[model samples]
Target chain A: MSEPFRFHTRLNLVELLGRRAGTVRELLTGIREVPGASIYHHTHRFLQQHHFLSPEPPNDFAYWISGSLGLNDIGERLASIDTVRYRRINDLRTRYVEILEEALAARRNSWPVCQESDEFHFMSCRTFIIPLPAVARDAGEFLDILGRISVNSLYYHVFESRLWLERGENDFAVWFEARGDHELAGALARLDPYTITLEGLRQEIIGLVRRHVQDR
Target chain B: MSRIDDYVPVAGASEVEELRLLAARLEGKTIRNVNSTAVGGGVAEILTRMLPLLKELGVDARWDVIKGNERFFAVTKNMHNALHGMDVPVTGDDLDFFVDVNRRNAAEMDLASDILFIHDPQPIALVERKGDLGGKWIWRCHIDFTDPRPEIWAFLKGYIERYDGAVFSAPAFSRPLSVRQVLISPSIDPLSDKNRDLGEDEIDRVCAGYGIDRGRPIVTQISRFDYLKDPVGVIKAYRMVKEHMDCQLVLAGGGATDDPEGLRVLDEVKREAEGDPDVLVLFLPPASDIEINALQRASSVVLQKSLKEGFGLTVAEALWKAKPVIASAVGGIPLQIAHKYSGILTRTVEGAAFWIKQLLQEPEYARKLGVNGREHIRANYLITRHIRDYLLLFLSLYFEKDVIRL
Candidate 1:
């Protein structure tokens, strides 16, 4: 057997950059100038914080643009960015910037501004990834530990590692493919993680892995 | 005194274990929390409950109360009001006295620890001893900084910048400072007396003791008799709701003895509710957590009509009990409510009255809101999450990078 898959989880602490924007123009500047950490924080904050209730929650930019600035058209476009398709934070950020630039061009004369209290405060987070006690030596052991691990551990493996960390594939799929399970690895890779809740994703993965383990 | 293990069921078992892991990183460090008043305010209450859990997690946590005279408190009180944008008169001498009091407390107390966490404006000046103490200092501001008085903010800014970092209850409270600023929202202990689950018998007995009838739908606002809480606006909203249906309003809280303005506001509320029999005005004594819990549980709709607020933990408390809440979108109240998802957020007295009437008329919708609200509080506003954030914050100070692998 290959090396064991070490399960790791992260604890994130959010910090306010003390920069705020009331208009789309200012938001564009912030999206361009702020570090990638700030961009990651805004896009993925709700997923980490509200893992239990997930109806494909919108990013902070979409939420503020629609709810506060009354720009549902551009907000919807931003929300439909297909986060799973982007393999890196810079790519996701570039897409957001492009959307805002188009919005700016279309509404050059009629730009709306949010109230002073309603401005979007830019924030970033620091994360500490620590090893959990759980490790899986084989597919059966991986399936067993997947059901009981914290949602945070699952999130780090599936979402954070796949997209923002630019790993090209989720850790589980990578592990499976390395173990010569091409069919199961492809199946896990095809799943769209953004559309489902964290727990829902866990169940789906468990079902797929269970079928493979039983067939073996 | 509920132990850390007692919160395992409330906050999931996995989360409790996760907190232990986060605390393990800071196993040998000592964290000293300095605040004013061992009783009464939110900071003290949180420290009282949190110190033991932190210690149980193997972090040597201790709390120290800064000493101050009544005159010093008065000056600091004015400073506090001024920081909230109120035009309170505070002279230069008063500022000097505030610093002098902190200097005296610094001399008397043991200022040695790996982390010195100073809470609020009273002990803010204690940062002056950082050179002698030689440790990381963090100032946790628990107030709204939307529009602070310039003179008072200028005075505090000098001291605030001297610290290694600052913590604000909400993003709105953060000021543009040179030091690092983190956003850490305040939390409610679910196992605490004010938030613990009460039996139907205890709830009914407490309501009966307060002369409340369980037959009518009850609307409650649990806050002190302060103008910022907008107790009078609450009565106005309740009267508007009363015009539509048969409902009762409960305004219950204490701690009005020290503030003369609180006494005046209490009297004004009485006059406004003089002829209304359904309006029950309760000025409960301190340590009335069980009564407050019962009042919230018995309430059909909970309200927090604050014109200005810090974080409005009452909203979280009511939501934790799965009760529908209507609160103003000021300060951190917006952080708790998602506007008709978990709970309702209002901007005016009419908006509040409309939601109150709508929720009472529609039972199923109200139930859904309450259920969603409980889940929201379970995920975000519990003390377990707060402790996790603090542990991460303590660890963040030692690492300069955004992502760390340990």
Candidate 2:
């Protein structure tokens, strides 16, 4: 755990996702069960900082993923796609998963094949949908996983909608900065997730995890 | 007696006459109460209101505030928490500082009354003058002592053993002391500005003054800005209710001069309530009793959501107003709230939220609780009833060996 990532970082993440993941452990555990919140968060941060975010004209999503986050093989498969042909967000998600299946094929040759229940997808009950697990050969699995999954049982049980109800806005941020978590403070100040739809969260989370993989 | 007729209206002619007759037994005895602050807090508030009435009943009642600087106040504040079983340490220097101020007060102030009432730990050391003054010293401990740390209790009991008797707000607070221990709960002066009945206009005006939408169901908690009061938890409970209904919450409180943690808790409460438009966090000034009264009267439900309390007067205040109260069952709260009878008693944030929603949802049940609550306070916890108890306690102090039953 990075000491620099303070409570403000969690607060910011909650804002970005539009709901709490429940307890700190629940949030951490939910992230762990998927791709990992820190990996996703850092990836998201790295991408936005590098101007690889969505809605930019002529932005090559394939170029952003290739060799960016430690997924060289996944990046190679993704880069083969005609980036110019992608029009809608769904087109990107569809094309993205097709490449992951190819990457999964390659990984199965090297590693023991995962059991019959390899069917994994997006699950959002609270603020966070589980990130694509590290075991996945492709980060693009996030798009498919985000497209389908049950309510996170752990997160649901620990669903803490009212944890920060005792503190003021920026109180956690100020405390983080005081504890020398300026990075966390800055990250927190940018998130405004109160009314964000699940669709909006998916894109936001996918970008983060993809960035995280690239940075790794 | 200093014009005994003043109370005849509230207590009725017979009750008032009986109280005066009880006071007649202790006639000519000068009762002096010494405490930390002259204003703010329940002890000071109760003393300010009760002393005059005691004097009116022919027991010469006087009030004196023991003086201390900020450092002294901070030390004593820690002592207060320690007494209530919080592991707030009081060092040797802190104890020395506490005694230094008490020694100065002991030398300067008049401890020459017939009955010396030392309220709480602030002036407990004044009992050091027991040998010099030889007056009957009573330590009135207005704190929750159900589970004090052994060292802290040992420290206080050293001085307590030298006193004639000890007075606690609840039976649970009474430890096995060598000195006689009496249970004397705090009381509400119905006519006091903070507890008096207010017109609907006044209630509405105060609500408007705070920018609260009075039409929405308002849940209010009136206490000092202390961590013990758990204003943060109150806001959380309010948020839980907001998830289901569009109700409003008002966390109104003031700080005592002697209390050092008030502002920090208030800031935390404000921060917790930052984005919520319906949660109103008010840091009321001293003597905002009428405003407090008006707020309580207007609130749909009142809460004394304390994590720890020493016979919470806020619960009693709300009950006296005939408002259905939701309070934690810690300390003397259960003594006042009959758990679904007079009012609902809850233990956690979810429970408090549930009760608040329940009361708001069922107005008839809420009203019934309120009506029953006011009667309960009237019969058991009013100022007049309190004075009679004190008079009886004072009379008991005169007897050396005999157990005087009221």
| Top lDDT model | 1
**How do all models score by TM-score?**
0.96, 0.60
Candidate 1: pairs in clash: none
Q: When only chain A is evaluated, what TM-score does every model earn?
A: 0.97, 0.24
- CAPRI class assigned to model 2: incorrect
Off by over 4 Å in 1: none
lDDT of 2 by residue, A1-216 (tens): 223211110111110121222222232233344322322232222122112112211112232233123345554565455432332323444555555555555534242222111111112111211221222223345334433422121111111211112122233233344555465545543443322322354455445545644655
- Give interface RMSD for all predictions: 1.3, 31.2
Off by over 4 Å in 2: A1-216, B1-6, B65-74, B86-89, B93-97, B100-110, B256-264, B400-406
lDDT of model 2 at residue A186?
A: 53
- Tens-digit per-residue lDDT, B77-131, candidate 2: 8887777667787898998888889999999997798999889888999988999
